[model samples]
Target: MSEKRPVFPEFDPDEVSSNPSDNRSFGDVVATRLSRRAALAGGTAAAAAFVMAGGSAQAAPRRGPAAGEEPAAAPAAESGRHGLLGFRQVETHDRDELVVPEGYRVQVLIPWGTPIQPDGPRWLKDASNSAADQEQQVGMHHDGMHYFPLGRGHRGGDRHGKGNERGLLVLNHEYIDQQILFPDGDEEMTGEKVDKALAAQGVSIVEVARGKDGQWRRVKSRYARKVHGNTPVTFSGPVTEKHPALQAGNRPMGTLNNCSMGVTPWGTYLACEENFNSYFGTEDPDWEPDTLQKRYGVDNVGFGYNWHTASERWDVAANPGEVNRFGWITEIDPKDPRQTPVKRTALGRFKREGCMVTEARGRFVGYSGDDQDGDYVYKFVGDRPWREHRRAGRSPLDHGRLHVARYNDDGSGDWLPLVHGEGELTTENGWKDQADVLIRTREAADAVGATRMDRPEWLAVNPKNKDVYVSLTNGSGWDSAATPRDPNPYGHIVRWREKGGDNTATSFHWDIFVLAGDPAYDEEVKLGDNLFGSPDGLWFDADGRLWIQTDVSNSSQNLPEKGYDNIGNNAMLAADPRTREIRRFLVGPRGAEITGVITTPDQRTMFVNVQHPGEATEAWGEPTPQNPRDVSNWPDFDPEGRPRSATLVITREDGGRIGA
Candidate 1:
């Protein structure tokens, strides 16, 4: 049978178009492509060699004894040397269960439909839970997440606490599967069906505790809360005044398509609203769509959620302004469950993958990706420096300066401010004010000539060096007659050092850290045993080891026709930035995306989320106890069992630090 492809969110025109001339309209030659495919296909060997050597340093010379001399013995793990040296790389697998390194063990922590509230309805085997039950229980399709310790004050626990035993796990539920979410498949749109779907898409904050034996489990606590798509939210920033639809007294209810996330210095969570334009319909006559809406692909035929059938708020034609409420970074306070999530407007509206916050020169700075091919990278600088005592009051994200990135062919880049009065972003260019510049960020970026990237997914800041790393996922359609850009069929990771080694700097130097692809496809750049593609879900541990996760499509996994076929399945990898050595750490189940990774402050226990397992399966015929048609029944590989997305806790068998 043919593999069923998953329907992802809509892509911007620039992301899918083949005309390279379209990129020329922005007034600059596209930055040189650093992808391995472009390198092998016919770029200069010197350039390819530079990329293989990690772009920053040349390959180290062999330090061992000569052929006639004896080689020295390797050092022990307990020695002063730190980081991922003790753990062996795990081979890629295409099984239906989570796979980890030999010494590491994985346990299923929290699965979707698990009840968070004491009185919430329990998960039924047949998947017959009600909309109210879903709202009270854990939502579906877990994505990005963070762990906040319970008794360590608002600052969280120390990195070497006694196991860092307890904390609140805040995770995002990206989307839902109608066939699996509803007991009876959703063949028709009903208020009940729509409600259940809505209840399954926002964020979940659950309290989890680790026992004396090192096992972790979710427990009922006052802090447990569910912020779904129907919850009420307030809009902040310049958008409220710039868009009449978001004016006073027009509070938007809930957030949809929450993809990736970030934690603020004040300890709040920032859940990104990605692909939100697909949730609303454009049939209302009163709604007049603008160029921005058209560019985002907002149209009459919705993503099939059909929320408009039961609620007018989902009808953009009737309430055109409502669309403006989404696409902004949402701030949620997990400690205070009753607090309403706030839409932070200062970050600028876009299909954000998420934002990563770090302190630089006493100020708070955030980096985020638009998550579409040909889109620009952005950064927001808070107006004031972060104060330890200010955690009780206002959010630092309320006021900030947003900037887009412009990369030079020589490995230098600058952050062009999105301020209205700035160059190219003036009245003559159709930017009326700061709000207008932010509301139409893509257009403003085009005007300023920001560099176009291939589906920037996640941003991570190295704890040791403060350098920033971004995952540029795979893309195609670069071969055009007018102009030709690199067709990065496989993904790669890009790292940049901020000018003067400061996170707030507007200028920086960058290099291709690692070109991801099958080793067989690229001989010169291949880092044996570490070859992987479509880099996504990046984070750095306290020890500064970068963890990279893969998100290969179902049709591409194990297919000989694809470049990544040799890399069994979507997996996670660890890399030491100093040496540029990337090693595979774990491989996730088939047809699932490995995402949402976080470890305890003690660095002993780690949590990783597996999203949408069995996504490639066809849901047809009547449901029965004998057989539940599934392409992959992960977590519980029972033939008749229904596949559910879940979280896995990984620990070392020797009771030592993870990845040691």
Candidate 2:
């Protein structure tokens, strides 16, 4: 009876158990029963040499194609195809919708309560709208996006002009389920349902265009805004003057759980504030907590979005600095919807999951990822260099030089420098300066030793070889006394290059570009046509073609006794990193989660994002009348409705581009 544990042992509610035949949310039966108890305590040739060098060969990727060959034909569409060239890889689907490929099409454009301003509020089928009509509509789960473009003039578009054909999408509304946004689910969590779930959590922007029949719609413009969770925003760098709970005249309100985003090459829009400590709670006792709130698992049982009964700044003992103004990196300026969103804070808050940026030799680097489970890997750079004009109101993420990575078991790494008086970041290692080394950036990267990883989330880069990648997305409680390596439990993709290929290089070299699981669990490092697992959203595009989404675990799709049944759903592969192939492009819709991809710089549109579909059955909350179904209605399954969370688009029916 002595094995109870879990008071949030870093959340293992049976791994996101809203239950769906519970395969222990991505732990695939606790990593196949800890690989059969480490092959009976270190035998079976030491657990097959630690699962083939924990996913073979310093994590494969010295150029593609080899793991089961076949990748070769992709040079046609006007002799300029990109990524996984000549395309033609698409077979896994538990189908509820979206599949893509064969000339591509997809559609859907917007979903989660779409309205796009102009006095919003009109999406109902029981979403009962109104937190002022979801702060004038369109917000809820549609994670990470970007598109800016407008009249082909500027703002990350105009690959050949008129192609982006008008934009300003922006996205990221990350959370809110309340049994699909209330109608009395869990008795509608109170008061205008927590003010329409805090106006359906942050960031939206809208404004899409294209139609003369070419598709892409959502137009209403006035820079169609949304930025919820109470919107005010401000803070800029050095934890807004050394965190006394982030000072600078106290501005920091909105932006929540935004997840995977980053645009700026002098165009703004970064979002990312993942899992905002699950919308905080813990009633005041004079709050205290610390150790960066227990290494960011922050408890007091909150993700129930009780929102401290509708605000006491959602409690943390009544505003213990509003969870330090939500894990930083906010930014937004999708062509100014009356500008305001700032955060930035020298880019160093954990739980961040996205932020890519890139400019290299002229500074402006970026690249984050601290999405839990043994966290680490970060970047930043930019003290000043990226001048394509923006001095009339500065903000290259306010000022940088963050760092953090470490790796080194030889394949090389090293970045460190979270600089607070440097070296052991000290006041004898208490780090009391650069905003306490950027608000205790994971205890100053575990006081300079770094390298914990195995759940880092996005970070793409590689516009034709700037090389950066990183996804890692699956970790499930390892530490049966350390030493397992490579981002254990079915998840990989590391990549690196830095140094001379400078992104302000502190040092680099890294490897491991694909070791996701179940191609019969590593037949020499899987992938012979996409046998994916975990690898959460990494992008690339503009003709570099890396893509790769995943997130698998709708009870391990198609469930082959919970072991990644030959990669059946939750997909969107694409790779090519110079012929290290990896195909299967697009395959979600059964329990969703094929998160945000993005394209259109005339790569002929693309988009992606699926997130939480039929979230493991049990027909979501509320909706009675003899169980009026609501778990997987999806894009319009409407068995009484409720399973939104969309944003697709795709294109190429004959227009070209898009993984041609």
Candidate 3:
């Protein structure tokens, strides 16, 4: 066990920086280099397209087939390529194991508690499930997801493979771990352990299927559902119904701290809402909390989900309008479970993590980030062409516009425009219209002068070129020539293009794509054995590769005195964005965190997700069954098991295509 304390909480997002006057805000100064094995020992092909992506060394740009597009050599990478990351990488190993690569073939699928309702009830070890049986099982940790096939075609469904043989995965249960969901693991606060930890925080879907022996199972359909955190959501654009600083109530509920996710070309399922100011609290010793709940970190012991000292609707001073209906962006419709799950709120709210979506200029944008640290970076767009506001039923994320992102150090940027009465929002700066600026979307993105990044987690796009990438994940003093890092402690990845490739271009141009640490504390990460660091989940694969994932928490993974123990656990790489190459394709287990990845539409069944594997075992405060998990019991090693997070599925034992 790596004896490092701080095992997450204090409403983590590696947090701290509610903008203490210019939390440094990218003034510029990042030009380091020489690692990735000293830039691959000076090899050629433009030094193998160099770009270790940190403070720009540049060289790696080839990109082909666009104007009149036609480059179809699909047995995997050929169109403009350095073999577009074709497998065989997997290295760093602290193995409590789910390693992958070597003809990959994983398969765990749906873990936390399983049972997608068929009168629920499966999973039960010593950890006795139940907050209504963890809301019909399955919900705990797994983050950012998407699959959806079930009788296909809404845009790349069945991906040319039998409507993906029945689908509907969905995912995102980003919370709950009261030491493996209670059984007196860390007992005491009740309301039935805060209703089984807000019934294991929101979003699930389930309905999988592939079984004709190709393996994928779990289909007790009625299109399986979950959505809880106090479910009963509803609300949409322009802050839903006249915002007077949003005093909303009348049964407004939502998608909870469900992290990393997005998907909707009308297929639905976005579920963002990171750290919802940790499930609120206040046993009122004179309850305080203003300055937008301390600029949205809200404390009084949350993150340890004391759900308001055992639930009074998570007492923010007795339901302060139930924490203004939770940090927005819900939108589920996993093939209709009677719809209901909207939120949207013009996609502004802070704590939102991933959103992605493309198709610019003719509208339908969407790009989101707001994951804290010096927060900001958003998009939105759509005032049309989301099938023209879903054929008049409205809600292309409530008739678009949002914006906010500034960057500039010469690499140019500016999307700015959180709009209210324009510039610095009006009504003497506290705007009163656009529903109080979409209910204080970070004080209307701190009234205009945006660019405060370094926490912008999950965002990816590349419908063959309008680019976009993201995953700032950590931060320090901020230098901003695209994440120049200060004390960043590994964590990078940024990319952009959008201007002429206009994803509704409000102007753009960026760099630094992949610098997630360790070339001996990163001289722009020189990938020796493909060492990795905090780049938290991204995705691209339709063969443009990208992929990446890693969270490194649990007091910074194996801690080599904090240089991140040779970067082992928490992995999942595969870059090659025009050959800046990156490799290691899967490594998660001890203390797991390689999260939500997707595939299948003939991308041959990938899936991923691991999450909270051993809950950072220092004997996880009494995780019994003869002290279950000192590191991991992953995908069930059942000695009365107790480490689960699960949903791997992998496959490629010749079925080909995953990461091809």
Best by lDDT: 1
The clash numbers for all candidates, in the given order, read: 1, 11, 6
> Which is superior by lDDT, 1 or 2?
1
**Per-residue lDDT for 189-214 in model 2, tens only?**
56677778878878888887777787
By summed lDDT, which 10 consecutive residues of candidate 1 come out lowest? 477-486
Candidate 2 has an lDDT of 0.67
lDDT of 2 at 242: 49
Compose the digit string of candidate 3's lDDT tens values, residues 1-660. 123412222224437767544422642412222212221222122123223222233333432233344322112212334466667776787778877778878888788888886568888877777688888888888888888766645246345556676778889888877866787755577887777777777888888777778888787888897888767777777776334454544466657778887887777888888778777788788988887777777766667667677667777876776677778888888878887888888777878887888776556788988877788779988766788767778777888788888776545577988878888788886577776677678867776767777678888886555578888767663654445545576667777665556687787656565556666654434466677887878888776778888886666677666677788677888877665667788888788788888887777788888888887532223244356666677777887768888788888888878877
Q: Let me know the TM-score candidate 3 reaches against the reference structure.
A: 0.35
TM-score for candidate 2:
0.33
Better of 1 and 3 by lDDT: 1
Ranking by TM-score: 1, 3, 2
Candidate 2 Cα deviation (angstroms), residue 321: 10
TM-score: model 1 vs. ground truth = 0.86
> lDDT per model, in order?
0.72, 0.67, 0.71
TM-score of each: 0.86, 0.33, 0.35
